[model samples]
Target: MLKLREKLLLNTALLALVLILQLAGLMKGINTKVDSLLPSPSPSLLSVLTAFGGDVFLIAFSLLTVLLDVRNSGKLSRETLVFLVSAVIGLVIVGVLKVAINEPRPRNHGGFSFPSGHTYRGAIIAVYASNRWKRATPLAVLFALGVAMTRLLLHVHWFGDVLFSLLLAPWVYSIVKATQDSWLPLYRRVISRLGLGAFDVE
Candidate 1:
């Protein structure tokens, strides 16, 4: 568990690191270097691999996590709620940054791509799964790295973008964990009062 002060400090440091990397023009150099070394996989195979980090997969995965908890615990669990809320927060953060930063992709295709959304979701899954299952941390980290690599191979994001996702995930998770104690009970009470007791974690 992270204390609030620790979480704040960590978040500030991450933000500072990414900003410095961007301002120093190191991001473009790294992206170009990585692109030169890594060969893009076949389009069909890349499509399938990248889907693991897309919206459909993540939504299904999130619902499945909550449903499995319901099956075993007979109600929503606080950990599942924390995961869901943190995921939502992460999405919002990414969306706002994408618009605000307006950074173009390496491929110069469509969408603004400052931070890789696919990598962000993958990292979030890694953090949540590792918290729930200590033994799975290595596999979880590999999965997240795979997602990050896919974004680079697809030319949809810069190296720095995915790097930021990797940093942002743990920082977001730490904040969620640190603040959960204050919000969980209020969430429970609100859901209970709304006659949604089955969804209540408390």
Candidate 2:
């Protein structure tokens, strides 16, 4: 498993690299170049596949995992809680950045689109699932990559946007892990106080 300190360092490096690329004026060129290579959108297959990363699908998927955990274990797992919290926090971060940066989409889709929300959520779910099931790392990664590709193909996001989402994923997981590890006792206490004792997963 990746440690918190390593994740912090990696996130810093990624942010620096994004800044450097943006400053060098290569970000737009890169997005344009990649966009040119993709074929016009086909609403059937690509639409179906891309929905795997959609808000409804991802949210339902997250809840389903939690429900499954409860069904099998009789209590919520800390890992599951962390995954849900991380995903929610990640969404908020993406939303804030999208509004703050106010970047536009590639095909004039008419909304702030610095970062791809689908790709971000996909990365979070992929990394979280991979962490839980080590053997599934390749599939998780491929799923995330496919989501990123679909965004680009649909002309909904810039390359840099999805790149940042992918780069930020592990770091988000790591931070959530570290925080939960340290504050778990408090978390348990709070859950107990709230009459949700079944959620107190060690």
Across residues 42-89, which tens digit of lDDT does each residue of candidate 2 receive?
857877888888999888988788788878887887778888888888
Q: Write the per-residue lDDT of candidate 1 for residues 1-202, one digit (tens) a residue.
A: 9876886798779767996887677678887788677777777887788788888988999999878987888787777777888889998999988998788887666988888899999999988988988999999999999999988888888888999988888888878878988888888879888998668774
Query: For each predicted model, how many residue pairs clash, with residues at least 3 apart or on different chains?
Result: 0, 0
- Cα deviation at 72, candidate 1, in Å, is 1.2
Which one is best on TM-score? 1
**What are the per-model C-alpha RMSD values against the true structure?**
2.4, 2.3
- For each candidate in turn, the TM-score is 0.90, 0.89
lDDT of each: 0.84, 0.82
Candidate of highest lDDT: 1
